[model samples]
Target: MTRYRPPQPQSSPYISKPGYKALNEELKGLWKTRREVTAALSAAAAEGDRSENAEYIYRKKQLREIDRRIRYLQKRLDVLIIVDKPPTNQQQVFFGAWVELEDEEGNSVAYRIVGPDEFNVEKNWISMDSPVARALMKKSLDDEVSVQRPAGPIHYIITGIHYTED
Candidate 1:
């Protein structure tokens, strides 16, 4: 099978105020953890031969992961534009809007439109660049949106829209 893959498109550079704060906090915490890991790695290296040292190998892997995430967050935070206030027109769906949708089966689902870097499935926060969010953008109450999925197209009606910190 062919394993070639194309580069993905760049995500939107807009983030909510809370999302920005969270990213900044994470970057700071990662730096602290990296320092601790460096110390542990050095200690492990000093113990003896490095080839058989499990602690040293594990610490090295941990440090690499930390450094990767740190670099990503640093670059992302530099370009992110924080959207702290609600739009002048709150009737439509926009970035950081809490949206409620009713599906064909009459089941209701709630989601928040957020930046790609801060999307949390557990909290139903979707990335603004996601298919559903793109369909919902600029849509008003009672507006219908259809998102194309791998299986088929799913339709939804905009039941509610709100702008809240949560």
Candidate 2:
């Protein structure tokens, strides 16, 4: 049997100013970490019997992971378009907007629309390419949004929209 996987969708090239800075910092740190790991790997290799050397194996794996992230960051950084300015029309929902939504149950939720690279669930930051964000885009306060989720169509009403981090 063949294991066939569909091609993944492309991530949006937009990134917030802070997200770009964070990626740059991470890339720099990874380079420094790679140097230290390389030194450790060399030290472990010098101890002889690489097949039995746990430290050498561990360092090699660590270095590989670090390199993989560094490469991804480098490429992604090169193509990312930093979105630092707020939209001219602040009344409407757009990128980098902190949107407050209300459900039919009177439950309120706040979500910040952010770039795919910077979206964090803990921070309530949703990727702009996400279904919820896409549905919310260009919507004004009191606008109703219906997102088609796997379970069902989830509904939300835009209660507030702000451009700032708060």
Candidate 3:
């Protein structure tokens, strides 16, 4: 028997316009790949015994994974709200805003608050549900915010907030 586990909290149903388009393209690509895999499986099945055909087994597994991802993307895309425009109140931090923060030690860092689907650490894009993003939400320039992290509490001052790319 499998161990019992609680259901996870639902992620925010928000995505950037580019993210939405990328997901749609991925779904389409997966469909094409699935068709190719199905054809390969058929060819492999005709060549040997069902139980001993490694090529058939691999193709079947690949097709199953592709189908699973296609299902997930279809469901996720249906509910995502694309945020293509900046919020009316640009003075405060909001979704898709690029925020610059300064720590007590005078170090500075910047991050863009984006949907969970598009958060990329390499680009300094943070998910809206993250602790830092949550603390900065609705905060204005010069405002001090504290975030409770696993390492402990950290304070930051909002140095800049911009809705457009810089």
Q: How displaced is residue 40 in candidate 1, in Å?
A: 0.5
By TM-score rank, best first, the candidates go 2, 1, 3
Please report how far candidate 1 places residue 90 from its true position, in Å.
0.9
Tens digit of lDDT per residue, candidate 3, span 1-166? 8899999889888888998998999999999999999999999999979798999999999999999999999999999999999999999999999999999999999999999988999999999989899999999999999999889999999999998744
Best by lDDT: 1
Which sequence of candidate numbers ranks them by lDDT, best first? 1, 2, 3
The lDDT values for all models are 0.97, 0.95, 0.93
Off by over 4 Å in 1: 1-5
Error of 1 at 111 (Å): 1.0
Worst 10 residues of 3 by lDDT: 157-166
Question: Candidates' TM-scores?
Answer: 0.94, 0.95, 0.92
Between the candidate structures 2 and 3, which one is better when assessed by TM-score?
A: 2
Clashing pairs in 3: none
Superior candidate under lDDT, 1 versus 2 = 1
Residue-by-residue lDDT tens digits, candidate 2, 1-166 = 8799888888999988999999899899999999999999999999999999999999999999999999899889989999999999999999999999998899999999999999999999999999999999999999999999999998999999999965
